[model samples]
Target: MESNSSPSSSPIPIFSTFTSPFEGSSKKSDLTKKPLSLWPGMYHSPVTLALWETRSNIFERLLDPPLDAPPQTELITKTPSRSRMTIMYNFSTDYLLREQYRDPWNEVRIGKLLEDLDALAGTISVKHCSDDDSTTRPLYLVTASVDKMVLKKPISVDVDLNIVGAVTWVGRSSIEIQLDVTQPATADATDSVALTANFIFVARDYKTGKAAPVNRLIPETEREKSLYEAAETRNQLRKRKFKDEKKELDNGEVDKFEELLAEGRIFCDMPALADRDSILLRDTRLENSLICQPQQRNIHGRIFGGFLMHRAFELAFSTAYTFAGMMPSFLEVDHVDFLRPVDVGNFLRFKSCVLYTECENPDHPLIHVEVVAHVTRPEFRSSEVSNRFYFTFTVRPEAKAMNNGRRIRKVVPATEEEAHRIVERMDADSL
Candidate 1:
């Protein structure tokens, strides 16, 4: 998806309500409820969608979702600002086509769904931190829970049908969400598989990162709170681990898992210090060391600002993630300033720090990292913010293969801007 320009209050519409014929027929038109709003700003502009259509597997990520709920006919003047609601979805084409192939919108069409969700939750935070006190904010958490019918039959290639999704959240960092895939009405080849998902989000403090208490919770009303509580329970259930009674590691497997486990654990629980110890050291008033490379002049001899930015983000986050353990999610990135130019193949290294974290969310920790790339020939090196910018990362658990026997943890930044220059770069899901 193209970088969203800014959070706007424009209206976008979706259909969410459904009428049942014998209360058994399944179709987008049979949805029990219609979408709550129809704000144009909620939908992606034609230019953005057109650009994404050119990519592979990515086309599935931008599909439009079907709404069955009643559209909110009333127009309100209050539109909200943008929040950092990022989602990552992974899928196979046959599975997606089997479920939503004939539905029109296909693949990873989650960005817009998340954007609209943020609008419904009132004021939410998108950026990890605010300049005020250097505190972090909570973004809503989302998880998609697909029904069993689709889970039983994962679509494979040449089948023309597949299922693609993510346990994605695109609202306040504190809010949680889930999505599920379901089967079509009939098991016929012509029947288009129906696809829909549920969203649960909450508003949170921009600073002191806590869940702002619910001012109004109606027990009888089956609104967001009910869905949130249920999703939270389900999430907890999914996270449960059963001890392996007879699954002992064979000779070298234990040692290999230990090595990766130790490396990956840094991303989850890194300690802080001031003196130049390996992990956290302060140099001058800057906090940590950085390698600022001279501006790069391309291989063909032309200066490429793009290549420099990519390298800067990659090297900088590499250190932060290495310290955190897991592959970090790329969060946010400020614009860069290219002061001078350096030649191609000039070695560059980035120096950085674990600046004040997003104070609000202790669970979903946000590390503010900065980078200054320096050009290192056998002769010289310089350091400056002219090539400097910030990146955000959130710590998460590592995969079993990478974790070994120990509980492995790592960090993931949420935005491409924090690591990659391209807005359309594959997210953690693709990685």
Candidate 2:
């Protein structure tokens, strides 16, 4: 099969419209009745109460069975390969930021797009595992990792978004889903690739909470074979990286300090920022904390992964903008690791800092921002790291030229360990 071939010629009916349970009822009096408060001092009308409940139920039913709950049968038929599972979403004005449409750099929020990708990948995983008898037991899936995501073009507000997700590879308990974002060609132009991503999800038995087996993906077409092979290559890389990280931590065989010293020599010869009152990493650092609200909860009643990712991205973007003193175009999101699940009502704290920057050319400056999420229990004043996100952005050339041709700020590591680690990670990413 061709890479761009449609999964099927017929309509896949991947999405289902929900009919509100209270759709056609002579409930004018009931609608006016006030419902109990969802929280302290937060009451809602009966109409809102009904709608919220119905919406939540519809989302849960459409997605997957509630976590730790009894298994429920799915309505859709199952397929073995990626060809049968496909999902597409159309973008609307609601997805765009007001007054930012004209700005080339300020297009659709990458956070929002990532959220949709996560949802679609999860949906595809479920469909791949679902079969006639398997539906009797619920299989819970969670995103373990999002591989490097590259954005080829900025997603404008007016164009419709075409997202397609399919199972590329599967393991004993994990499945890899490949998602491609594109804009369909119109009479005026041709289709363009916007972004591509690979997500790995692990299945768990709802009752036992143990790793569960997923159906194997049988690659019948050339496209499927290619995707499968790519997934395998990535899987191997992940394993190797993990092993190397463990080895480094255990033995410290590689001298990161020496590596940093070598790299520092290369940058030392470049123009120093001391000539101009330059910015430092501390100057661009930002910290934000907020309580996770119920609205951000997923069907499983835990904080949504996409919500966390969006928050992290926003913080990273702010850091990049502040350091660059210009609007930065998002280039790509590096590997995002979801360490643990966060519960609702927890205080989530985000700390963002400029990890690396290079502006020797002045015309083309690169900025790398890192955001780490921490979940805290306010009562105990205790916090645990939840996730880490790395992002890359490039500043507008014109803006860089406007600031007296000043060089972008450099991140000076205060501690030798930190300097070594940062340099090591940067070098690894380059490889």
Candidate 3:
């Protein structure tokens, strides 16, 4: 565990997203935090104190040259091992849920972990693209999308956590980084793997603002070769999916949507005819909006993708909680898309709803939630989707029983838009 004392050199600005560190004046801006009627969960954590202590140090570091611009040079091929990185948290030595990343429950807050993963991936992408011998960051990098993140095992805050990653694949401008989280073998138990995540980052020239070719990746080991191949396949699928979305209106999609609309209409008109209890998809919806803050900006000065993920995950959890009417345990985060970058001062709106549910087990129903983030400019009368998030959660049987034994209500799409969203999820699974 990191002590309260600050490092001599600047460490990463880990908590700058929550508190304003660079702004000097006290003038109230739209980005400033304001009073709210109600705040949820255990918001007070020791991390706040850490953030306060590091704010000044982080600001001083921000004064240094960003070095984002690098002179264009001849291409050079590099091995993936050159960019490999492994970061670990020694929480088992001295730790408490309130001292580190945790929520109302004693379990780890997945939202915070997602932020850490993004930071790590960003660092790796920088390392992979840099040709200079010095450690100064050079290339402009931004997260493109995330393939998938599945939690195979529950992560406990008290255990020493290890995050291992390396460059898996590369293109003219984009690079794929694979990160795996695990716990080392303990005296009592063997090593336990928790989750794996893949982050795609696109490299851009700071001056030309064009796609910057990265150093070619050469796999050193069999495992590395396998990973490279897998990433290539994933990339191919992404391209194909994008092409499919651009095709002209086909009968296949139209006919499928008609069936969904018809089924939804019948269920809405005759509720008693449903095989199991259900609810309208709109009823399971929840939303909140925020003014994008400069503190949350990435190195490129745009809103951080990880920050967006954190907000989207929280909204998705709330949607599932309302639908289940009980506290839910997070299962996994499936595929997600970062369609566009969100700029500072943008009115960011997050809309979430229960997309579907599995009630095979009445007590512990599986809930799939979707969250869509839009950057709305009321001044220009423009609202465009910037990202899409998908999350899965389930409630404990005992907790469900406490809700008067109300089984999870299956989500029925009543509108064409809703039907389209549901089909998108179904298609994403195959991808």
Candidate 4:
């Protein structure tokens, strides 16, 4: 276990020797530096599918999970370093590896990155909760939500990438993990930080499917202490926001939205304002639906949380691209909520919309997009929201001059309810 903090007092032996699925022409490093490659006989396997196999044994031990981690190994306290780990995507030298993560524009696919983060976070959670003397655990972990992920710089698909994650905080049945994505220093440039992400995972008993207690995480250093504190603050904010949504909007908030709604109506009623500069939110919508595939399922037999995020991100990217009339670059993932799990064979529908746009810089507009996932079941007569995702993107610099149609300068809500969502979903810290 390695990070900016101290090493774990007792690190898990298996994680200390874990390696990614790259078995060809690849030399494995210590657990701290597991270099990943796309080829290990599964030539065209989804990068995540192969990586999943590498970490599958951890799941099998828990409730998919025969549950009996050596009861004797259970400790009273665990530190952040105990779960710290890093993996590498050696795309800088592996052409085959780069192909799996690259998009049409030869840039790293944000969707794939989302999947990687989820997979890595899951492993970290397991590492933290593991008793460490058995196959893996007595508890199963699942992603609860992604607090945030922001790109510090544009990630190159052909560069080697390092993903490091560790446990930041833990409650009886919940764990907060933070991940940093960076590029190793090269001859021409110093080490570069590409992205940072925070994810929350909840633990459950394999046998009973009930919330299960995890190890106590005692911060061992100043950095770890700060991270631990921040996670607590963020958790409080999330709970507050959830409660706020159930309350009625105050007079001032309602007035402000009404004014914006009036402006959109004026733009529609007045012929002189129709320049296609502003788009009705409804006009920027795009949708897609698919049956949850078993190949994308996690060890628990439900569609992997990361796979769901992978699909939602691509849809959000498309919404931004079509709305902006240019290629879009991912900026940040503001927030996400996993309301429920989608099982294999379930019909999942993704609805994406251009929630809002900030065109302060005419050449590069910042677009906010929202994606809602619904588990639609006709026989059960329910089409409930299974997930909600919010993402931020901007027009690529080179593509700014390449307009697909009229420039999209604004996105205006056509209804009061839609107006409420736009205002409430905003994260003030990001602003």
Which stretches of model 2 miss by more than 4 angstroms? 1-106, 132-135, 184-191, 248-279, 402-404
Off by more than 4 A, model 1: 1-279, 282-300, 345-347, 376-386, 397-431
Task: Please give the distance, in angstroms, between residue 295's alpha carbon in candidate 4 and its true position after superposition.
Answer: 0.7
Candidate 4 lDDT, 62-95, residue by residue in tens: 4245555423245458878777876777777777
Which candidate gets the maximum TM-score versus the true structure? Answer: 4
- Cα-lDDT of candidate 4: 0.74
Task: Please give the CA lDDT of all the candidate structures.
Answer: 0.33, 0.65, 0.72, 0.74
Span of 10 residues, lowest total lDDT, candidate 1? 141-150
Clashing pairs in 4: 62-65
Between candidates 3 and 4, the one scoring higher on TM-score is 4
lDDT of 2 by residue, 20-63 (tens): 23445578854753322232211122222332332332333433
Please provide, for model 1 over 265-369, each residue's C-alpha lDDT reduced to its tens digit, 9 standing for 90 to 100.
443365332112222213111223233333232111323344444455555566556555555544444323344444445555555644334435434555555
The all-Cα superposition gives candidate 3 an RMSD in Å to the true structure of 8.0
| Order of quality (TM-score) | 4, 3, 2, 1
Candidate 3 lDDT over residue span 1-431, tens digit each: 11112232223322222333434556665246432111121122223223223332332222242556345476677767766766656666644432457577766788978876787777677767766533333556789989789887667776667776778899999999998877655555464668899999998766566788888888867788898899999999889888888565468767767877777887778878864676778878899999988667754678878788989999998888877779998988987778989988999999999988878877667889999999999999999999989998998777866878876776778998899887777666545
As a TM-score, model 1 comes out at 0.28
Two-way TM-score contest, 2 vs 3, winner = 3
